[model samples]
Target chain A: MTDRQDRKAFFRELGKYSALGLEMALSVVIGMGIGYYLDRWLGTGPWLTIVWIGLGFAAGVRSLYRAAVRSGKDLERDEERRRKPGGP
Target chain B: MRKAILVLLAVAALPATALAAGGHGFSWFMMLPGGERLFYMYAAVFIAVFLLVAAAVVVGGKKTEEMVIPDPRFTLRNLFELILGFLQQLAEDIIGHHYKKYLPLLGTCFLFILFMNLIGLIPGFLPPTQKMNVTLGLALVIFLSTHYFGLRENGIAYLKHFLGPVWWMAPIMLPIEIISHLARPMSLSLRLFGNITGDHAVVAGFMALIPVVVPSVFMGLGVFVSFMQAFIFTVLSMIYISGAVTHAEEH
Candidate 1:
């Protein structure tokens, strides 16, 4: 690609990645907000809020973890398939 | 050569500069505008930007069918497909076959962070990720999402994952696990906030000094740091998610 085209592509990729990051961040914020509100409603003080909020955060992390594992395994499988004779 | 000359000229205009502009020095949060503090602003900006982008996405989705002009730039559909494919591959590799459900969340997280980090490179913009509140918010989501998925996947049994291998250790192990789980968000937020903030500060500091060939190198480093931070954040999130989804099996 021409230099200008490459630059444009780079910016586009950057924008795309930024969007992804924002989504993840927002999810955490939303989860925390919900946990806090639930705690207030249930009259559990800080304890329940902390616990449920922690749970929400954990759920987010778990999803992220799962994505990583899936990506890694898929790469391995693809590599293995590529190595196999007449695998195409 | 022209770019180098311009950089030098800019540097020359600045007053006396600190010796180590890029060092991880302490940032005074209270000193910011109106004593409003860094974290508070960070939260506000993150929420505002997120809402704006979300609205844009919704509007864009609604207009997907119509094309005003045949522009050579990549179309929204093509971009979405690319992102979907990337996220799908990531999910499938990590969660086995159930990757479809989590794709939207993971994909969105990765793309948003990547752009936020890149925004710092612009001349006048400060990256939202550089602030602790933003990172904290992001980390908090990952922290919560892990358990949410856990409960959804295994119900009450999800809590059992934190109880340790044997019943004897449940009392001690539960608290320990809880503390460690709490630390995840703290670590995630600190790591991102520290790296981006430090890198940006350094770039600014360097440009303030020697006004020569030096700052460009730091700018390159800034780019590298930005990309690495995004990758690490995504990887950690994935690890946490998979752990929650498959918690019951190992225990």
Candidate 2:
């Protein structure tokens, strides 16, 4: 039972981050989209576009970092649990 | 085995015959504007599922001596019970203790998306999920609800995470956070739309080329794709909502 539960948890965590690549790509696209619209609205040629695109790339990296941190913590917790007395 | 193959061939031929009869044109309903068509299809699917569930409830509730023994055969009530139980378990696992409040949203999303995808497998029906507008609309609902739950659960503290760890990093972190949040809906909708559309196209393409015993293989693959996509959408939505509502310090 414990073995099966571990497999289930493994799959759940796998599914959680399966779309990280797409999310990162869309972050950049959405950032550029927002930048383009803002430039049109305020008549600020290309400057805000550059700034927002950079922001979007930063956003993608941030999300990737967050996912890594989360999974790292999960691994640590799992290790701690496994090392406990009578743990499977 | 021979009889089963014959039936499968006949079922596969039905779509072609229907199209030929319709003069190779789409059904009247398909001619409606995209938004209107989506609305009508959703209403139709919603009502059909609601009626089926209501019937299942009524039938399953009947008092009987055999009720003491669990039914071995698959039944409508059993199907729903299985799905609900799965969702409940998923919520409890992901969202922790306060999971019940969100079950309604999660359950509806799973069932609705599953049925919507299954409908596309029929000879003449189109799945709304194959369209960007429909999937985006659903994704937006998830996005908005995540924020709503976050605000309700954590109040002012919810916005603190958006700001960042310290005062100096606010300017840099704020835009990144907003972009990340906006990307959630974009990613969700695009993934579902692309998967369904590609699956549908593959099935249709194979059906046109072979039109024999082979399309069934693709059709089987389509069913798996549909279920997998729905499951993925539900899993991601749960994770997002969990992230939103849970206290940041716990992470």
Colliding residue pairs in candidate 2: none
Model 2 reaches an interface RMSD of: 0.9
Give per-residue CA lDDT, model 2, range B98-123, as digits (tens).
89999989888888888888877776
Alpha-carbon runs more than 4 Å astray in model 1: A1-88, B1-84
Shift in Å, residue B185, candidate 1: 1.2
Q: List the candidate 2 regions with Cα displacement exceeding 4 Å.
A: A1-3, A83-88, B1-72, B249-251
Model 2 alpha-carbon miss at residue B207, Å: 0.6
10 residues in a row with least lDDT, candidate 1 chain B: B19-28
Q: What digit string (tens of lDDT, one per residue) describes model 1 on residues B183-240?
A: 5677678778888888887887776675456877988998888877776676567656
True contacts kept of each: 0.00, 0.90
A1-88: candidate 1 lDDT, tens digit per residue: 3454344334433433433343445445555666688788987777866665565555455435534564465456656766788764
Candidate 2 versus truth, CA RMSD in Å, comes to: 3.8
